[model samples]
Every structure is written in C-alpha cells, then in structure tokens.
Target: MSSTAHEAPPWLRPRAAYVHIPFCAHKCGYCDFASLAGADHLADRYLDALERETAAKLGEPHEVDTIFIGGGTPTRLEAPALERLARMVAHWLPLAEGGEWTVEANPGTLDAAKADVLAAAGVNRVSLGAQSFQPRLLAALERNHAPEEVGRAVAIVRDRFPRWSLDLIFGVPGSNIDDWKADLDATLALDPSHLSCYGLVYEKGTALWKQLQRGEVEPVVEDVEREMYELVMDRLEQAGLHLYEISNYARPGHESRHNLVYWANDAYWGLGLGAAEYVEGTRTVNTRDMQAYLKRIEAGESATGPNERLGPEERARETAMLMLRRTILGIDRADFRLRTGYDLDTLLGPVIVRFVGEGLLEDDGRRVRLTHEGRFLADRVLCEVV
Candidate 1:
C-alpha cells in the first residue's frame, strides 16, 4: 500500500518483534549467523547496549502481539544474565495478554534455571534446536547435544510452558529416508505442539560448504531431499501436526504467529545485532558486527545497516511471494487489492495463468494457492511469480 504522511502508518500496525541473541558456545559446521563463540563475556555488555537500542527505537509503549527471542542459543547466557535479559523483555516488550512470547534455545544448554527464568518472563513457547535425534547425523551437523538432551528439554518445557516447538533437519550428508523417519518419530514422541523441518542448506563460507568443496562431506542428493521433505509433510500430518507454512507444521492454533507476520508481509520490529525489521513499507537491518552494533547502540547512533523503502508494486510482489508459501492460507484477491491497491491478476496474471494451467496453482477466482504438484516445484513456480 502507499505510505501516508503519518510517521507510522496505521495500515502497518506493529504487532511482532524479533530480538536476536548472538552469543553461543560454538558455531555449527553449517552455521553462518552473526554469532560469536567464546563470547560469554560479551553478554552483559550486549544486553546493556540492546536495552538502549530497544528504548531508542520503541519511542512509546507498543502492545506487541508476538515476541520471538531467537539466537545463537539464548540459553548460553548464565542464569542471572538470562534473567536480566528476560527482565528487559518483560519490562519493555509489553506483550499482550495471552500473546505469544517464544524463546529459541539449544537443547543441552537450557538448564532448569534458564528455563525457569524464561518461564518467569512470560515466555509461553520454546523452540528447541533439536536438529536430529541420530548421534552420527548430529556429529556430522556439528551439534554438541546428545539425543537424550532433547527429551530432557522437552520434558522441562512441557512442565514450564504451555506450548513448544521442535526444529528438525533432514537431508543430512549420510541420512536416508528411514533415518528421517526415525527422527520424525522421535520428535513426535516428545509431544511438541509445533515442528519445523528444514533441508540442509550448504551456505557459502560455512564449514559444511568448505567440506563439500573439499569432498570431505557429501550432501544428500536433490531427489533424496525432495523425498525427505515429502516424508516430513506426510509424517507430520499423520501425527496431527498439519502443514501450515511450507517448512512448518503445527497442531491447530499452534502456528508461529511471529513468523506468520513475515509470511503475511506485515510490519515488525527487530532489536540487537543482525536483526531485520519491516515497518510502514520500509525494511532495515541492524549491523551484523557485534562490536559495531554494541558501540552504535551505546553511542546513541543508528545500528541499522541496510535500509530500503518499498513502493506499492514492490510490496505487492513481496507479499505475493511470501503469502504463497502458506500451504492453506492462500492469497485472497479482494483483500490483496484492498491492501495494495493493485489487481492481483494484472500484477501476476500471466505467471499465475501459466502455472495454473500447468497444474501448479489453483486460482478459483477469489483465492489463489499452490496445488500439490506446485508445492513440489515451489521454487520454480515462485520464480515465475516473483
């Protein structure tokens, strides 16, 4: 939609916030986030700077609908430090009643004290980074936690929180369909309300990427990866965790509200190093450098690195691309025009017609969504639309 003269457009109400915690015990082989290992000493300083940055940006109290504290393992902070961070969230975040407050944590590192701190801070959901249950696959993925730790964390979260999610990885170097099945089964056994299954991506500059280049580690073939993804869909559905987003499965009412804000192309606020925000047709990201981010926030300077103001066409295209990722909540043509003042068919008529004719999309006049075949070839179809 067009940006009005209002400083914060009413059309883009701020309902979501993402807080980044970039401290970790170690970096994984396949990781490239703005995380620093052996940086526990920086937590106190980072938190102090983060509070300043948050206060500077918030301007006034915002009744946030969802708050996600993601990380390089937020639990890596010591108990008192974690409590301090949680207190910051509780103090400034102003989470709405029964709002979703989620914390992303590593399995083994989340001790009882940390869990207690998060629970006390009103964090109602915990997303555990339990990539896989197999020890061999875990070692190959450079995960330090044992399989048993996942179960322990799940038990603790179950007792402390009302909802939780598990993140599982498939298409590992040596993993097969059966191994994936085993992992899915193990995850279901933990009784999580949500599950996010992702294929292993060998990003450039990661240790895994280098290993692939050096022929030290082989990635799962594309065909195998597709099969594993299909398996995840089938197994999660059978286990009652229905597919919501492409890579996320949730029991009814357990969907990740914060992430859906991005998929729905809505506004959000992000704080701390490397965090991204989209508010009122504009997008910006904080500096990825830890020291720079801290210094900038502490010095009362802008920490945002890249900034862009998206025009109407740009917003519509982005919204279409993102909303199309939803398995069930397809794009509504009438609502689309109301939101963006653009005819959906005019914007993507040719692309949609081409894919729909090819049995990739189902456009029933009112709404448009991917067919099963389209979902299988999502990348190709999305390329056509975007």
Candidate 2:
C-alpha cells in the first residue's frame, strides 16, 4: 500500500476522468449545479476553453478506465457541438480496453441525432435524467420534459447503448407513497439496467427552498420521505436490481464504474467548469463561474479555485466515510488498511461497536457494512463515524 521514493503512488494513477458541461436549456428550480440557462451563445466558447484546459492538463493522451461527461445536460448542445465535445474528450483521454464511457442526458434534450452522435463517439452508457414518471411531480420539480419523453429517450438509448441507467426523485412536495409506488412501477416497466433513486433535497437559495419558506410548497414529511426510500429498496430489489450503493441500484455487471471510483475514494481527473479533481491526496475544484474558468484557461493560468491536500489521518477518515456508502460491500478491513495505511480498529473501533449495538451497522470482523435498518439512518451514522 505504501510507495517507495522513486515510485508513483497508486492513488496518483487515476483511471477515471469527469468532464463537466455547464449549459442547460432550462435550469431547474431545485438545481444548484454550476450550469447556466439560456447560455447557448457561449456553448462553442465553452468548448473552446474546455479543449485548452484538457490539453493543458493532459499533455499527451491518457488512457482511462471510465470517462463521464455530466452536467447541465450535455445533450442540450446541438448535434454538431455535441460531436465536437465528444471527439475532443476522446482525443485527450483515450479509453482503456473494456472501459466505460458514460454521458448524462436529459429526456427533453435528447433526440435521434444527438443519441446517434453519442453512440458513434464510443459512449457505451447513457444515464437519462428521468426524474419522475408522474406529470404532476415533474411539474412540481420544474422539469421541462413531459412524462412521455422519458420512454422515447429510453428507447433511443436502448437501441444504441449496451446498457443505460435512469434517475428518479422521490419525496417531491405533495407526493405520497402511492405516487412513489407508481413511479417505481413505471421505472421497472422501462427495464433499465441501472437506477438512482434519490430523495428531493431543497437546498438553500433554490426556488423550491424559497417556496417552502413562503408556504407556496408543502414539503414531504420526514416519515413519508423515509417510507418512500424503504419502498424503493424493496421494489428495486424484487425487480432484480442489487442495491450497490445507498441510492444506486444496478443489475449485476451493470454498476456505474465511474461513480464507484468516487465511492471508493479513488483519485480521478475532473475537467471543465466547476469540476473537481483528486490526485495524490490533493483535491482541487475549478471555478464555478464559467467566465472565470474560460479566462483562466485563455490566459494559460490554473483554473483551480479551491483545493485541499489531505494528510494521512484526514484521508483515512474520509476513505472510511466514503467506503461505508457502499451498502453491500462496505469496508473491507484488510483493504482499508492497505489503502489508507491505518488500522480500522484503531481509527473507528469504538464508533463501530456503538453503532453495531444500536443495530445500525454489522461488523463480522472481516467487513464492516450498514445493516438494512442502518441504511434508513445512514446519514446520521456516517456523520458520527467521520
């Protein structure tokens, strides 16, 4: 696990790369990503700067195991622009054999031309942002796409890609258990290979958060939200998808390898506006301001905004926190020690024993994982662990 003076550490040799696209056709009310709405004029310019930044970061083409292009709807770009973006990424970051290249798309923005462009660019996986199957819930979330658009998008993705994933949101304001059940049923009918079901979060400064404050929206009660999550676990598991992470489910062999790099706290390369990269125990994020990122790249300056270099102890604790998010394979004691150079018992023995007594975690001496009941209070458990 340790490296010699002349050798490069394993964490420094990242196999995953993430590229951020910051243009969205319509910015959702609840979103806080570093994306711009009605910024179509800047699309080409953004890609121009992205090309420069990628070239600067990667002087020579680097092969990676997973490459994810995510953002304010990567599909929002015109077909030609999309093709340029894809080609640029492929040029700078060639894929390793059997590597997974994924693109995030919105149902409203995807079309046959765009889908074909992605497929032709070596994109083997597509994760469609099908937030919900219910019209009312979609409207409540300020989603521009109609419920029917999801099916059409899925059909296009299925035809071109080997495997695809769908994202669903529960606990939307005014939603109930029946509505959640209906959404689950509709999602299963799509026969998606992967699913990410998340609870709606009303982050501060978002339109939805303001509505909650002004009494314009009635947020889902905590108990109801918990019930919706439990239902998702039950329904998805019964449908043959394994709960790989707390919010992510996938059929065997279809799990998101790109995201798994994150849950395992492995190093990765993040490029473009507001993207964050971690390598050699240091994490740096590009500026969230699009113009700032462009100017920095144009001036041949660092686009990094804020960064931190974690010491050994900080990294070990963080590694534990992230690894615990994997519901099925939690933390392997031997692997943890190998990766972090820290003994699991010396770091978190007391915390583990306490939570295990509370029936929130299970430690069979070899692996440590959250139990079924522990998942409901995972956030609380994780907070205490860290």
In terms of TM-score, which candidate is strongest?
A: 2
C-alpha lDDT (0 to 100) for residue 295 of candidate 2:
90
How well is each residue in 224-292 modelled by candidate 2, as lDDT tens digits?
A: 999998899998899999999999999999999999999889889999999999977899999999888
For model 2 the local lDDT of residue 311 reads 88
For each of the candidates, the C-alpha root-mean-square deviation to the true structure, in angstroms, is 3.0, 2.8
- For residues 154-248, write the lDDT of model 1, one tens digit per residue: 88888899999999989899999999989988988887889988888899999999999999997898898889888888888888998888789
Poorest 10 consecutive residues by lDDT, candidate 2: 1-10
* Candidate 1, run of 10 with poorest lDDT: 1-10
Which residue pairs clash in candidate 2?
none
lDDT of 2: 0.91
